[model samples]
Target: MTIYTVTSRSISARWSRYVGAHSYRFSATSNAAMGQPAFVIFNNRFVLGTVSSLLPATLYNVKVEVLDGDGNVLAEAQTQQLTAPDVPLNINAYSKTSSSITVNWSAIPKATGYVLKAKAGSSIIQTIVNDSSGTLTGLQPYTLYTISVQSSNAGGNSQPSPPVETRTVLAAPVIHSFSPNFKTIMVNLEPVSQAVKYSFIIIRSDAVGNKIKKTITSTNVTFTDLDPGTWYTIKAHALDANGIPGDDKIKEQVTIPCSPNDIKIQEIHSGNLTVSWSASPLSDYYTTFVKRDDGLEVMCNTSLRSCYFQSECGFIYFISVFSYNKVGQSPPGNVLNYTTAPCCPMQVKDLYVSSDTIEVKWNPARGAEMYETKAQDVSSAVFCNDTSTICTLSGLKCNTIYNITIYSYSDIRGFNYSCQKKSITTGPCSPSILTITKVNPSTINVLWQQNNRDAMYKVFAFGKAGVRSCNSSGNSCEIANLPCGATFSVSAVATTPGGKSLPSYSLPVETAPCCPNSFSVTQITQSMTNVSWTAAIGAQSYTTLLESYKGQAKCHTGETHCLLGCITCSTYYTVSLSAISETGLMSMCNYQGYSSSGCCPSAVKLYRLGSNALRVYWHATAGSVNYIVNVTSDNGNFTCSPMSGYTYCDISEIYCGDIYTVIVSPVSIDGSMVMFCPMKMYSVSCSMNSGAMVIYRGKRSLFHNKA
Candidate 1:
């Protein structure tokens, strides 16, 4: 019998046909086991038989026998031990690369060779090798492949080892081009085959090992945030589905030079400006540009870090700098805004003059920082500085022509521009030290000092009555028609052809009082008189004086009336009334009057004619034409008059045990009565026969009894 096929569990064999045979029986046994062999019986005329239940990759002894129906051997055929090899164990695919995969498995004892099968999608590939390991070539990159290894000898290939799932690494990407700028770089690459993603790494060539890495699903990638004016090395690779990286593709590139930094102004002159800046790396040269406010441009190029350009004065400019190399020019650096120094100032206009000050104005300069004004005369010079177009120069000589100059200044040193000299005349100086030389009841004289001798002066007096003015060419002037008893603010102003000067410091003055009018005196008592007059226009108070050969008396009052007391009786007096002003000026008016005799009835003699009647007699007053007596008591009051030319009076109904007060008034020939005269007292007493007795008392007795 000849063995046909052997497997891990079964074996098949072919044998020659037995003549006149009944059937054939086949048996299989393991060489390592001491068990009965597995047998199979075949029918007559069978030439092929198979044995079941056989161990895989084991030495199996197979025998086929031709037998008759009686179970006796007619002929037999048996061979040596033969079996198929065991299945390969621990199958693995490793060392995977783009378009290649290596499959490996445990070696089978006495195996002739090993076969590797690799399948991807619907495509399959087989490779044969004498060793236990085999490689599959020309496979797709980054593809998932299932692989298996089988050991083969005289037996057909054992069951393929357990399948191994693996994927090939992606291919390396190709760099197509690089885009470089001042601060960034973009890299372009060819697409890798079967790549799920791509990886990139960038390293600065001049720096100390700073690596930037990125992974993306796209083939084209750009590296951002890179340093300018630097050389870099970029690497790119593809990754498989398992995240395994392929070989790297590397390239080198250089970015454009960076912009110049930290621009500064070195020097500024009347017609030129010099600027500098910090140097930029990888730059071969630098260029500076300047643009004026009027749309004019100027540029300078240099290999160094600084440059200079011609400029116009009194102009504004915008400036910038850029670095350049063989690649291109970098972006412009920070822009600089600059203003040139000012030129000479324009014509001065709007010149205004006052007493001691001159205001000067001019058209504005293009770039002036401040303006200055100077005024100079024969005796003095004044100066003013201001940022605006106008300035004032003060404390200048009055009524004088001054040479005025305006200057425009800038922040730059030694760049002050001056205008042409201008001539201006100031107004007259104000009159000073005002004084009132003389003050009258209705007029005043004023004097002042002034430097402008050729100037005309006007003196003004401001009062409650009205404003009064006087004009004079001299230093003194008199103002007339001033109201009396009024205070006036007096000042002086000087005027010339230029203008009027400011008013001088004011001085306060008061006019003298007017004389009192309508002075009169009226007798109030024998010793007192009422002096009255019309109110004076400027009088603050009134004073009355009464002078006689015997003595003198005076009284003062603020009203129109004053009372003069303590006059000598029956004496003539000169009554003088003066109206006094607030400034102690006075005017007087006089009147003559005669004082009356004492109001009491002096040297009185009383006669009792009847029990209720009494006769009274007294000395006559000098100015009296008639006399009247007033008697007062607790019971009642009574009055009696004497004859027209007499001074004696009679009292009727004199009562007993009663005290009486008697006042005697003198009536002048004009029929004016003088009251408040001295009083006399009398007491009436009753006698034993009922007769009334009259007792006379003096003026002191009347006052003592009333007190």
Candidate 2:
């Protein structure tokens, strides 16, 4: 590669004799001359180099000549034209699954097509590329990958791109959690000539796709709780599926493997597997895992340094750890064990099984890159691992047990076989946690107990309610247009990378009845009433109750004279009063048709006739058959008596001078005064009819006193 340059200083270190002349040559720049070129020497003293990096691929003309002996051209050399460079390399990526990874790169600008390849060690992980992109299916978590692309044309070949790299896609992030200190992994892709976009995916080890994984356009991505000490490969490729290079292909780059301490299990319920460890001495390593014997893979990267592996009902699992970087995988760390046993489990101390997969973990053999694990179902047995323990074995019949063997390894490349450890068998998975959640008034969200290797969410609507199915990460669903207050039946199951979970169901759940709003009462007749309410939202017709009362005070008071499915203004109600809705939640007002109005003049009393004593009597405005009379004097003299019919009372104890008072009120069937009027007083009157006598209608008698 040549660079553009102007001669800076060309004082010859030592002069050499010109081939065919006695003259010698020297070089210098015009700027360095202080004011101008020290001497006029066209092609000899002022030598300039072409700027290759700055030169565009467009046409450029070049001329060359050789100066011999003196500052003069001795011979003309070659003239050349520069052409634009072929399109660089193109690259892109996608996922065959949550665990598998795919990547593609553009063919060389002048080449026929592209050839794709991936390397972990010297071992080619994947190779083949009639197409630009190729999938590396079923990769292990926390593994580093060296990805590359070379350009080819009929002319033979151009140089290969600086090694492009990518980590296999990491297992999805574990635990859908929100916290303040969550670690964010920032992936930096190499700078290319053009501004291009890319697609990325983040999956938790035990989860289905996030159901909402965000596609980041920026080169750097922030992921929380990555598997520590484990190498995670997040692929970056051009947005074009054809891997078409726009102008310059971006150099593929994988994330630096996180430290093992950063990878950990966040939580566990059945809590069969969760890996927690302190920071290791190594900086180039990152990854933590709870390997299931059930053929499920689990890994996490986070500072809290933990990973979760859920135990199914009959399955078992254990944990293993390793840290690594670009150069190579590190020795394996300590192994931890756990299990989910059913009935009588003999392998519990060393192993566990979930469905067909069985997992086993033991104390780490020092210096192991990982442990080699194997499983034998009722049928077939296979060994798969360069270096790793806690292997998952599959292909067993449902609910059946199988034997397992484990071995220790020093280096995956060096130690290819398993060492000795105890043997065990597999078991079945636990019943999925079928939870019903209300997402909205019209929708339900169903989910199951958490598992690292979970795959899909299945919902079953069955029985008298008929049957239906919906797939989602949310375990629950919204059943729309269901009759309010109607009973419904439902069941849910969870699918995992290892196997399927058991189904759980809800007891006859029922929808709530709608309660009416805007309740009101109207007088139908002098003696009748009507009540009404508005329709409740998202529910059956509003339930209404009516009550009749005699005053401005609302007749509601939780009383109802009539029960209404639907009431218009003219609904002639019997004044029935009752509570409404499932919970009887109601407004403050009662059905006024049946409830009484504020008592009118609770008690009425007549003024005094004389000063010595007073009498009290009253009458209710409504139905009443009897009354009562009580009398008290200002001097504290008091009396009481039962009275009927006529609403008046008179007491005798006439005195020449003294204030007296009287009260009159009505009584009810309960013998309590339905209406009461307050007492009034009058100074002793000389005449008992003083007030009435003043209103005498007849003309005063002017004639002589008749006998």
Candidate 3:
């Protein structure tokens, strides 16, 4: 007989067919064991049989026999020295990575070693191990694998166990770059092999339980709403369809620094400026940036909270602060706006001055937004404000010296620059209430209210002759040598060391005219008189007036001589003369003239006295001391004498019935006289016994009889 197949638990063998064989029997026995071997029986038609009760990897002897109807053996076959191990069971694959896998199986009986095979995409890898489990290596990442295990001994090898199918994990993701901001952080990763998604986590290093998680299909991820100036740990991993994770990539990052607070200006000087701010967390240093309106920029870096830089006056500066570290610079902190103090005003000049107002001008100051000027004196203080170079101050004391100061302002609060103190003197005040105190024929005295105690005064007189002026230390002054008969405008002015004032209110004054000389009156008549005088200086006309008891007369002329008419006869008269000037001022002559009557007498009368006595009467005459009367008749001539101081005269020794001539005459104190008579016939009746007579003169008859 010959052996065909052998197993760890059993053995089979075959032989040639026997002739006329009813059945077959097979038997196998181990050569090293002392126990009986196993056997098997078959039918007459069979030629093969397997032996039972065999040991694994043990030497065995197998025999087959053929028999006739019931008695003895016809033929027999025999085989020896055949052995095999049992098959492995329960095969599995676990712990899969990107390039490797671990496999395990149940151990077979009497097996000395194991053999593992891994297959993927028509390629197979074999490995021999003495243990039940082994790892498969040198495989592609993220690939499917089919794995199997087999038992082996020194005699022979058994069949493999059932196959197990699995796939390796995906490759780990690689970190590429990191981006950080004040409040956010972003992570970028390299692509992973066979990765369907990625998982990311960020944890704050300074805080407990502060973390963020995300899963995405892309390789980049960003975490937001984070604190500034903070440190964070980042992790990223690739994932498979089964949610299996690969190796992780880890990194550390930091956000930018936090913004600074409470920016301030510490100090400012002519050429330097200092700035400060509150500190920022996690910042190594601070930076201050300054920008000017004129396109100039500067910066200062410091580890402290404050910084200093060069500065200039009158410039607008924009300032900002930033926190910085080795990682990066943070966003700018609070922005500050500032301006330096301006320079003082220069080149001060006086523009105008009045009694109570003063105007001043100066050069423009750099960085100055407003200007203030102050004028101070012993008695008053005044101020002016302006945006430009010129300023006007009012309500100032006149004729006084004032100290001046100028201040300049800028954007810096409560700060101003000032210049050197200066001095200015105001003009003297104008005199008021001008008055002409005294006036003479050739001079005028003027007075005014004094505005300043220490000032000098000047009085001016303007007339037809010309302008005349007078100066005095007091308020009153006299203008001498003024022309007569002229009206003048007078004014007063005050002067000091500062300046002269305007003229005061004007007053009009007039001077009197001089009297005329050599005044006389001659050629006096009953109806007219003559008057003459020497011309007076500045005389325009002459006036003559005559006065009498009966009548009076007046005359006016431009010449020195004039006549007075309408004089009464035999009457006393008085006369006067006056000189008139062009301004209607008059001055009378000092002399006067008087005239007495120098005319003849008038009116005559005759009367008859008893018998031998007769009387005649006539009117009296001025300046005649005595009178004489003459009576004439055809029979005789007669003479008569009048009483003293009386205008009547008596005639005696008359003849009756005689033709007579009657006449009357006046004698002066100078003793020169004249008379005239007319002849007339008078009728007289005489009676010797009765003692009575009647007389006739002219057309009247007079008779007287003794009783």
Provide the overall lDDT of each model, using Cα atoms, as 2-decimal numbers.
0.77, 0.43, 0.74
Question: Which of the numbered candidates is closest to the native, going by highest lDDT?
Answer: 1
Q: How many clashes in each candidate?
A: 4, 108, 5
Q: Candidate 2: where is the Cα deviation over 4 Å? A: 1-350, 355-357, 361-546, 549-622, 654-656, 668-676, 687-707
Name the best candidate (by TM-score). Answer: 1
- lDDT by residue (1-707, candidate 2, tens digit) is 12232111111122223345333222222222243222223333344433222222222223344466554666433322322324335555544333345776654333454445556786665544454556765555434566665443322223344465554433332222111221344554443323245444454333433522334445555566654333333434433323332222222222233234433433354435566776655454455666666688767654444555555533345666655555233445556555442211123233445655565555544445555556655576666464443455555443443455554443222342333334443332443544666554334555555443344666665645455567765434455544443445666666654456556545444445434445565434223345555554333223344422312222332332332322222123333223334444322223334332223334444444444444444545544345555544465544454554455556667553445444444343346553333454534545655322111111332222111
**Looking at model 2, which ten-residue stretch has the lowest summed lDDT?**
5-14
What's the true lDDT of residue 614 in model 3? 57
CA displacement after TM-score superposition, residue 49 of candidate 2 (Å): 99
Write candidate 1's Cα lDDT for 1-707 as tens digits: 77777766678889988787898888887778777889999898789888877765677767888889898889988885555567889887865467788877788887888888888889998888998888999887677889988777776677678888987777778886454567677887788766788888888876655799889998777777776666788899888767888868888866667788889975455577889998898888988999999899989999998888887667878999989886567877788888776766677874778977888778887778887777878877787888889887877777888998877788753346545778887898878855687665577788788678478999889988789999988888889988767788998888887778988899987877777657877777667777788888889898888898889888889999878788766676776878898778887766666554444445555545566766666776555446777788887777888887775677787776677777776665465555666667787665513323356666445322221
Alpha-carbon deviation at 704 in model 2, angstroms: 29
Q: Residue by residue across 1-707, what tens digits does model 3's lDDT show?
A: 66667666677767777778888777877778887667777887777677756777787767776766794677877767446777788887964567778988887777888888889978898888888889888777788889888787765566677889878777667776444569888788888877889999999876556678899999988788877776788888889878898767788787788767888874545678889888888889988899987889999999999998887767778999989876556878767777777877889988887666778899998888888899999876788877888988888887888888888876564336446868887878888755676566676677777778588888888878689999988878778888766678888788876667778888887666556757776644445567787877768998888777776778999988887777664455676767788878787665655653344345555556776655666666665446667777776778776766787777778765555566665553355444222333345545422233334445465433222
What number of backbone clashes does candidate 2 have, counting pairs of residues 3 or more apart or in separate chains?
108
